[model samples]
Target: MNVEDAPEGVEEPQILPLDAWHRARGGRMVPFAGYLMPVQYEGIMAEHLWTRESAGLFDVSHMGQLVFTHDGDIATVVRALESVLPGDVAGLGDGRMRYSLLLNEEGGILDDLMVTRRGSEIYMVVNGATKYDDIGHLLDALPDDVTMNLQDEQALLAVQGPKAVDALARLVPGVEALVFMTAGAFDWNGHALWISRSGYTGEDGFEVSIPAEAAAAFADALCAEPEVKPIGLGARDSLRLEAGLPLYGHDLDPETTPVMADLGFALSKRRREAADFAGAQRILAEREAGPAVKRVGLLVTGRQPVREGASVVAEDGAVIGRVTSGGFAPTLGAAIAMAYVPAELAAPGSGVRLVQRGKVHEATVAAMPFVPHRYVRASASPQTPSKAGA
Candidate 1:
């Protein structure tokens, strides 16, 4: 989703704990997801390049932090979650996390989230704009024994890039030991923190979940490091796009299915065999027969950037598909985009035509991750491959 624009019908924007801190550092504040957030600090291009070369900090406190617990069987809680989400929650080991999609009864995606198994409690981070809707859906589907706690008092931050580990490990020792998609509990200056070795950028990074009251101090400490600087939502969007990650409410929505969105990897083999999750029948059938349209990457032929709402048209000028995400890729030094097109035209190297405001632009279908991913993983660990956009 575009971070600069707030959704329609939203109430007055709320202030985050770091509102003053951001403004003090010259952050350009804007309305986003019913909150006044910074869209840029130094600048989008400067911050985007800095994160790729060194380390950049991001304030993602707007995301929802949820914890699930049960006094009864933990297996019951797993079963309840599996009924709504397609991921293999039972197979997740302690401190392990998985990228999952919240699906409707028809198999349409309601929201995309990260679910981590932390001992007896299940921790989840959902998109800020749809957290309340997601909570309502889970409450209606979960068993009475399963309890969901929304951690509104927490603030989330992400430090990402080649040197992110070096900068963050200094504040909280032992965080460097965690591998990709793993998490652990730690303490810093008497405050509790739940940190995970994962992030939206396709670089080595860590996301810290800390107490909201101590957020400013923690942010200050992080930025004090020579290698780290505070980044904004603009660079975060470009980074995730270059990483070929989908943005919720933009690249994914209720009308989109996992198969159609090219996110079939989220469906574990064990769950696919059992065929027990929501929308199993339609999803499985689409997996076998193929989706009508597939999400693919596009390499524009010029320096001019393409924005959302552009159309993928046929030779005769009939609208065939639409662009979901598009922008100038700073890392690639060219323009790139993500769009849904006919399955026949989804192959890499296939030619396509794009039209925005009566101007036709030539583009070629290409593989995703316009930029290569640099996540750090242990060779001995049997963890599954890292999921895009997690």
Candidate 2:
């Protein structure tokens, strides 16, 4: 199938480093993020449940791995990035990562990304579909002093689930010590690796960045463990949805801001206090008075699942919002959805209507994460010095 937000013209789907491995494992490939990625293996439901019960390996190599550097100190690089993103990149400690957004001049979201301070340099992971656009935006917006390097030769993997830690710990020792949102450099069979204690799935897991040439071997080694299985995009979407996480181009876009998306947390305390970031005036005002509309979760009354672009209507048949993402929540045993609605109508338990397949389904404003997030929250600590390695 064609991918969402694919370029206008028809183009050949690119192959990932693990493309062959995915097909070898019975993966049903589909076009996504401009690549022929595995959408499912075994089945979506089975893989979804297996990931929640055991470790599920995911091939996220399609994501853009980027490195930002400057001839000056880390502080200079941090300040430059802070102008574009609302996150506290300047105060971010070494080995620590923060979920942040690239905002437009009007405070609208351009893309969501993970920012990690790797020694004097900064590393970033952006969504696959938006990486090219993001790179161009950075080059144009950032100062001439900052340099951007896209790691095209690198590949990414995610080992997510309750058993994820144990499965990965067995491969690279010491990774177990890294708390949530923390990362460190390590060596696996002499191949340098960058592992982060974080994932899109709410479950405790790690995202490992390795050389493209070693990606297949590394993935094979992880799957060798009895607790681990290779999961595909179908399960990955379900898992993230259950975790209440939002997907770019679906739940988020350039038209939405952090406050409107219920992602104000990405605006760090320091940034909020200083109000020094891009679109600060508009974002801060919305924070205090609330946005005209907000993103919220919905629980459909029946077994039928709603889908993206579904109209969210009111009791009087007035369209109030639109479903950004929705589906049968296997874990919840019910249909759930994420949508944007007027702030007053976004309260939990508020009644709404979901129009899917030309049928209006009863729905209620529900709390997100249809499932609970199992992130291993880190304890309070002082900043540590940077370590040198991949």
In terms of TM-score, the best-performing candidate is 1
Q: What Cα-based lDDT does every candidate model obtain?
A: 0.90, 0.87
Model 2 regions lying over 4 Å from their true place: 1-10, 380-390
- The alpha-carbon deviation from the true structure for residue 254 of candidate 2, after best TM-score superposition, in angstroms, is 0.6
Tens-digit lDDT track of model 2 for 1-390 = 011232344367879998999999999999998889999989999999999888999999989888887874788788888978898898789999888999997899999999999999899999988887887788777888887788878899999988998989999999989987899999999999999988987777899999999999999999999999999999999888877789999999999999999998798898899998878999999999999999999998988889999998877788889999988888889888899999999899999888877798988998876787766656633122111111
Question: Candidate 1: minimum summed lDDT over ten consecutive residues — where?
Answer: 1-10
Tell me how candidate 1 scores on lDDT. 0.90
Error of 1 at 26 (Å): 0.7
Off by over 4 Å in 1: 1-10, 380-387
Compute each candidate's TM-score over C-alphas: 0.95, 0.94
For model 2, give the 10-residue run with minimal summed lDDT: 381-390
The C-alpha RMSD in Å for every predicted model, in order, reads: 4.0, 5.4
